[model samples]
Target: MAKAIQKITLDRSEDIPFDKLELSQKNVRNIKAGVSIEDLANDIALRGLLMSLNVRPVLGDNDEETGRYEVPAGGRRYRALELLIKQKRMAKTEPIPCIVKRGASTSVEDDSLAENVHRLQLHPLDQFRAFQTLHLQGLGEEEMAARYFVSVSTVRQRLRLASVSPRLLDLYANDEMKLEQVMAFSITNDHVRQEQVWDTVSRSHVREPYYIRRLLTEAAVRAADRRAVYVGVEAYEAAGGVVMRDLFEQDQGGWLQDPALLEQLVFEKLKTDAEALKAEEGWKWVDAAIDFPYGHASGLRRFYGERTELSADELARYDEVKAQYDKLDADYAKAEDYSEETETRLEELGNELDRLNDRPHVFDLEEVARGGVFVSLDASGELKIERGFVRPEDEPAGEVDDADDGDNDGNVGVATSVTGGISVNGKPVAVETQEEEDDKIRPLSDRVIEDLTAARTIALRNALASDPIMAFVAALHAFVLKTFFLYGSDSCLEVTMQSAKFGQTQGLGDTVGAKEIEQRHEAWGHDLPKTPAELWDYLVALDEASRQALFAHCVSLSLNAVVQPWNRRPAAIAHAEQLARSIGFDMVDAGWTPTVDNYLGRVTKAHILQAVREAKGEQSAQLIDHLKKPDMAREAARLLEGSGWLPEPLRLAVDETPAVQSNDDAAELVGDNVVEGADADLPAFLAEDADSEDAASEGAEVEEHRHLDPAE
Candidate 1:
């Protein structure tokens, strides 16, 4: 027969008066934790006590029960009740529920410890669903937050988590997915899309929270994007555009889902703004776009507008500030050190007077009639209107030759020329010129001009299509036009090349590639002529090497291999691979390392281990494998330094043949083998911890094996 099972006896519970329940010193909880006493009291006062207090009868000196109980386990709940009585919300005689411990073998401290330790906090998924349940039961977010004593945002965050794809929720519930990953999935409400992203990241070695967010919002425009800021999120939503938000993390103003609509709205708004600006400022022509290429202002005649005269009040203020500023400046320069307050005051006074002096700019009437405007969004997303740019064709007449005048003597009349600039002190100085009636050249009739140009245009097209050399040159001309002109419609051929803009990609501007491009762009900008009209002649005059270099730069800027969700390009990416292979490109050689910030921190702990195992060895990986994900990543980064361990995305295909993987070798990703030369592989912090006995033991173990240094 099986051993007879012992019957269990639970402590009896009773409704004891609040006044009779006394606090016990044997309670183990002395430190404060979650949910403040005041908030808990308020909660209890609102909802009444949910859990009963665990108490035992207070014994006198005679070992007889006193007419009172002492709480041991539910001290916090007891305090909550006491607080309600103190606040006069609950009466002293109010009966409180209590679980009576009668003649228990366990000590009061043991009971208290068991109550807190043996209990399980509610699972995150359960808590999320609880909020959802309360919401479905007609409770508002504020109402639920009030009931739980949490903030409204906290309740909403939980609700958002609960509202995630039910499949993902189930995974979270089953502990198959992390809460952070679940939060990332909550950015979008499209269940199908959410599940799809989950499926995609689930297979990848790195599924960090941020990476998940990036993958989900790849096609969407960031709310901080110039276009999104120009077209406010409210207007985008009003126009039926979806904005995906992350309640758990800062989304950098969130993401606008409807990119097509956003683009359309941005374009329409920019065009409207340009039209309004042109009407207000009397500009001849206005070209509006989301962005002009890098060297758009090249080859244009830029004229600064005149500042309006200051008002009397502004003038007085400027004078007052300037007097104070001048005195302060003299004192500051004479003093050995300046106070922060003094420095700040000087800056303030200077800025104030500067603002007063820098009045609104107004273009001249003649400039307004002859010049044009380029309208677009600036880096900060405000409407940027660049005015008073005179195109080559719109420039005023140059010096008139006396040979053109039939009645003039053979005398060269030295008149000022507006078309050409004179170098004075190495700077181009502008001299205003007046037009002469004799110098004006009359145009032919429109029909006659069209007839002459039509023949030339048709013949040119035929000539370009036949000669590959000229065709290349013509294509190069269009690329230059597109790359350097705000309105690049100069080309007769329909060929277009639009460089990908990466304004929203954080830190991209600071990248090695970006810096090199900027340097090259600035060099070319300094060398190029004043206007796009002269760009063709300049290109034609360049040597073959110079032309090829410029050509390569223009073509390189147009190359975009970014993988976007809405803009999938398998063939293009493959073509990029072919190009890379031809050039023998390597991201490692390009100066990319698996630092904690860029690679290791963005991947899962397993991926970090896998990388270390591959680059170093199983033994080297195991040294840091037992650490937390963040710590592991940092150490792995150090271990893999100069090891050239590239992620799959950065890896180039050396051949068409697929390399085989090993199952048995993969199983040794985190083994306990001694790392040979592991002293060199371990980080300084880990190895130099002389005070840590654990570190000493690890260091000794590392010394046993000498040839498994991860960095090597």
Candidate 2:
């Protein structure tokens, strides 16, 4: 039959008539508008229409109320055109090309159903969307399936896919997963399982459709199981599937999932089965020889008579097969040529051999029984035979006559014996005896004692040395005790005299009084005795005593130095005098000359003198003369400059002294020999030197220059 062709001119909206359209309402399914009308309009503007619209002729006469006809399948296209027309991009009168079917013989529903069932093949997702649209429109699954020429199960599966969580549907729509993957994931009807499938599929880089489906399937199953999901090649074997040796050897996911556990379980089962097999069969040897002409039939055999009943032809055939296997086994046994394939084949052959050898063979009891085999008659009078070169039944059994005679020596007997000495009724009896030998004893040597004593000495020294105050007190006690023992009641005076001498030597003088010295001596010496042995004990204590005294004296000196004002130099001198008096010594005898005291006094006086001289703008000749000495000039210059005595010019001159020397011999002579001249010119030079020196000294002052007295 020639196909009917028709040309159609229809209103843009009415051109694709719903009545003549072949796509069923069920087939029209859900007209899911994924994109907005704006997007469709844009797509139409750029690409025009890629698909032809389905339409049907208007029934009876055209509508009189409206000038346009209704659309069928091209609703989206019609809307797009309407947008373009409103935007003035397309003419309102423009005619859209479409195919039309006559409505006289076909109902709108029948045409729609035929178009969806026979003409169009929709994508799984699109089909799902279509089913949803029909379902929402109140069409049943069976009716939709019948109308669309699809199975009810197919329609239901599609509907289920559509009903899947939106999160999972998005994965399908975005091409993150395939419809089949989504379909497999939909099996569980669990959102968590679907999500897991989506997650597994999306994260994987599997571009192949098969792998994506497989991964999704496995992930869904695992999500359902809620256990550690093993996938890939390892899963096959772990699930008890038989795998080829080569396949097993490969690093497939099946074995890789948990190799240790799988291998252990497999080998343990194999071992258990092998042990059980071994126990069921008594030990027996089968001829392993391979015949040359008859292949494996060349070796000796010791089987029972009944096994020998097989024809020679049957044996020869067996030998031929066995020989071929032997050759293969020999080739495999070569180390360089050995491989998993060969090993697997060898294992199979060995297993077969084991099975064959396990078969039972009949034997004559009378002939075997005379050759060390045992024959027994049971209560039922049935004869039983055991065959072997060595019969266990013929071996002699051991006997024990008495439990006490463990060795079973017929003639030997045991007798009781006593230790130390044997006695009967208090009378000594003859007994075996051994002699005792003497061993020499030695005493500890002097060297060992010396080492121990040295260790003790070091411990004591460390304890005494820990604190200087303790050492000082120990020294005082020792001195007092030694004096007391040597001179009796005169020790107090003697100790006072020594303290005085010590104070004077340190220049502390009379600040430390005799009463304080006596009190300190008594406090430290009270624990000591007046005997020679006590003197030794006092000496031991002296180290700490002396340390205490020295520390005390140093503290007193520091206090005096800090407390005395800059103008009170004689205060320290007087304080030293007091210390000397307390220790029962004259300050002068302890190296405190009047000059030394005066020098210290001058240190305080000089600071004031320096400031006064600086304020007057006139240097003191006495001070300047004292500072001019080689050792004192640098220090004096520092103090003078620090005090603002010299003006900017002299200060600059002093600073430029090095450069002046570098200029020439005369310049050198001027800087080196001009001090006296500089001093002489002080009235004019001091002003300039002071200003320049002040600017030069702006940042950090030299610490050495801040103090006027060098002793300070």
Candidate number with greatest lDDT: 1
Q: Which stretches of candidate 2 lie over 4 Å from their true place?
A: 1-123, 126-166, 174-197, 200-272, 283-310, 313-712
TM-score of each: 0.56, 0.20
Top candidate, metric TM-score: 1
- lDDT tens digits, residue span 1-712, model 2: 9988888654343343322233323235356645667777777787777666656544445533232344466566667777888998877766666765443375655655565567555567787888999999999989887666567977887787787778878877888666656655554445765576566545544334444334433322221121122122344355663321111112222212233444344334333433343234332211110000100111111223333444576556557657767988877667675488877877776666555444455544433332222222222222223233222222224421333233212111111111221111111222322112112212222222222222222222223333445445534643654554332211111233221111111112122232243334334443344344666656566676564654554332122211111222222222222232333332222222222121212223343344335544445534343321222333343344434342211121212223444446666543234322223322122112222135445333233224422321
List the candidate 1 regions with Cα displacement exceeding 4 Å. 1-11, 60-63, 294-321, 332-345, 360-364, 390-712
What is the RMSD of candidate 2?
Answer: 42.0
Quote the positional error of residue 62 for candidate 1 in Å.
Answer: 5.5
lDDT of 1 at 370: 79
Clashing residue pair totals per candidate (backbone < 3 A): 7, 68
How much is 292 displaced in model 1, in angstroms?
A: 2.4
| Model 2 residue 388 CA deviation in Å | 19
